[model samples]
Target: MIVSDPATPHRREGFESAPDPRLYNDDLAPTEPIRRTWTTYNYLALWFSMSMEVTTYMLASSLIAGGMNWKQAVLTILLGNVIVLIPMLLNAHAGAKYGIPFPVFVRASFGPMGANIPAILRAIVACGWFGIQSWIGGQAIAQMVAVLAPSTTGSPVVTWVCFLGFWALNMFVIWRGVESIRFLQSFSAPFMLIMSGLLLFFMLHKAGGFGPMLSAPSHFATHSAFWHFFFPSLTAMVGYWATLSLNIPDFTRYAKNQESQLVGQAFGLPVAMVLYSFIGIACTSASTIVFGRPIWSPVELLGEFHQPFLAFLGLVALLIATLNVNIGANVVGPSNDISNLAPSVISFRTGGLITGFLGLAMMPWKLMASFGSYVFGWLVGYSGLLGPVAGIMVADYFLVRGTQLDTYSLYRRGGMYEYSKGINPAAMISLVVGVAAALVGRVMPLVSFLYDYAWFVGFFLSGALYFVMMLGHRVRRSAVVS
Candidate 1:
């Protein structure tokens, strides 16, 4: 029901033809309520599909390896997702009510052109993630090949070949576009659950029993030690899904109703995160009992499987799992960001190809180059950017505009969104303040502790600052509702 004033002309100065046909498509428009076809089940499948991936497994496994017992690891993962699902669901509101993608939704806050700044930051991270996922998928394939042909296991050439092959596979899926992705999720979702169940059984069998693994003694040794590790890991876990939080509108635009998106994500995200993180923790603990060390990477762990059949099957499961997540999380967001750069010139297909190329250029093997990069830099560092962006956006959409957007103005060259010549100084300034606070740890030795909770700090500070700045500019509602 929230929509733009239809009496207002859709055209604007400079760009006589706004949202040009060549560049514009229904995919990017503020979808009519009748056209919003996705149901709660679709949204559920979305989170269930995206969260059940190798990256998620690794997150849980890493926490376990970091000395948290299984209980603590599961608690952190559960609490983090429960916290993040708030913003994810809040942001989804505009998309469901108005049927606009994330870029256009934030355009109200950032500006017609300046929106690109935050969009690009999010896109770049997704691109890096695309490469990382492709590499993970490729590694899974290579591991399977090695089991079938042990001689080929360590060949760098083989790894690159498999990477390209998997990259091409992603490209093909993207070529077919979002509809294809939806189809993929529908089919892959059930399979993922079954495979995960099988993985759980395998772990239980390998470790001999669940009691020891579940009851594994905490490595933290003391409450203070546990808390120190808990906070950073918690932030990192939130950061894991922060990008998806910002861009969820990209998918929720198709939502049939708010109930569908909300209930679906509520059931799907937190539950899936807790379940997978539990598996990761349990499997890692079990590995210690069986293999003498806690192997965090599922790809490496599966590679160690003595039975070639199970190894190959596990690798296949990993590949399918990564594919389910990569296209949804990594490919779609960046592609939409790139397409936004020049809508008339770049379709979704073109943007996806660009994402694939950017993936190759980053050589994610290097980004995941070290455990430090994987754990702290890539996850926490990017959260500094995404968290502020999310904070400003949610504040603007919910507090400033009361979630009512002038949809037509979003595409026009000069309109309400052209605040301060296509840039909202209030939003930008708040973003800087938030990011600086989050990053102060880098320069100030005394404040280095803040670095561990960058996402939390950035989100809270940015949201508060933006709400205050916008309170002065926001058109107050007449006779506020109780």
Candidate 2:
């Protein structure tokens, strides 16, 4: 039962009276309603900041390079983001309703101890993303440094110095905590949008307008070829965001209400993604006309400008954009996830620090070396792993529990969530089955399409399996008053 205080009417009474020491910590505790101040604008700003990064540019341009026309490329990105938004909003509902982060929220379906499985999996992926974004930010810094001091150009030491310096900046922000991220995103979103528009204006002027910029014909020779490539590219696009589809609760837990999260995400995600992706596609297509070849990397494209001041400004914008995405998208979930493990021992700051160090160890430079490796191998590969987790979370929350979570029980041992010693076999088994089905194509050449459609296959198969497996199992209704 929720005990309302007259003085703090908005604050939902949590398990604060006495929560299990083994399972509870300040960081993992349910958010007080009074503290849930994030509004629709905050969520909109969050997506806008995240969407205007170098990776999103690469994602769109890579599609064009892979043989699609500019129109085809933008359409794919639009459709993919729209598809992923469904799951994104679904998972966010639990967070908004329960005022709990993803780790605590997952305890309902995965069990308290078993929740660590998905938490760790999601954390590892966030580490890789952290590394990638840091590398991009570092490259921007190095480019600026090289412009200022011509002699430092192509120097490995200078590159490493800039990389480490940029990495440190990200860590400093993470150390400041989540509110810093909110401030950063809210402050940077409009500025990044303006910078993106300026970049687009420059590209359009260079290419002599959209006629030449988007004139490139589709490279697919036949209808069959286009269809064949479309499915995987669509899947790759969906896979690009599959990570966030599961961990969205980490952010939405702070939302003032479900309407704020849902409407904000609806207005923010797909629109920003499509708009920025269009900028990327147009700029890249324009590059072929201006530079005599396609230059996909924005950093490299900026370097072509002979005016050091112009390049410096562009690089600065890129730096801010990278930092916004890295801190907001990459750091939050992993910090919360890592803190969930031994909550008494590790705090969010410590978990973020661990994430930073592990990101360096991932050697993200190698991952970003080629477009094929980055898009097909890395994006699609991780999507296969995360899709099932999303499937189970959505199925369990919306279908099984009817979006009602027992908040008090979530942070206690020997509660409704303590399935078979704190591990839900049904969820585990379904996750394994989902992953196997989605990834089977990797081993069996004939069914390789399964790997292409990794996210869809894993999501549907696992959600169905979990629903069936959960039948006849007793689920306790939420005790926390709404």
In TM-score terms, which candidate is top? 2
lDDT of 2 by residue, 1-482 (tens): 33233122123445234667767788888787788999999999999999999999999999988899998999999999999999999999987877788898889899999999999989999999999999989988989998899898888998899999999999999989989998999889999999999999998998999999999999999999998889888888998788788889889989999999999999999999999999999999999999999888999899888889989999999999999999898988998899999899999999999999999999999999988889888888888888999999999988887776667678778877898999999999999999998888888999999998998999999989998898756343333333
After best superposition, candidate 2 residue 93: deviation in angstroms? Answer: 0.4
Best by lDDT: 2
- TM-score, structure 1 vs. true: 0.94
Give the clashing pairs for model 2. Answer: none
RMSD of candidates 1 onward, in order: 3.1, 2.9
Cα lDDT of candidate 2 equals 0.89
**What's the lDDT for all of these models?**
0.83, 0.89
Cα TM-score per model: 0.94, 0.95
- Give residue 112's error in model 1 in angstroms: 0.7
Worst 10 residues of 1 by lDDT: 6-15
Model 2 ranges off by over 4 Å: 1-17, 474-482
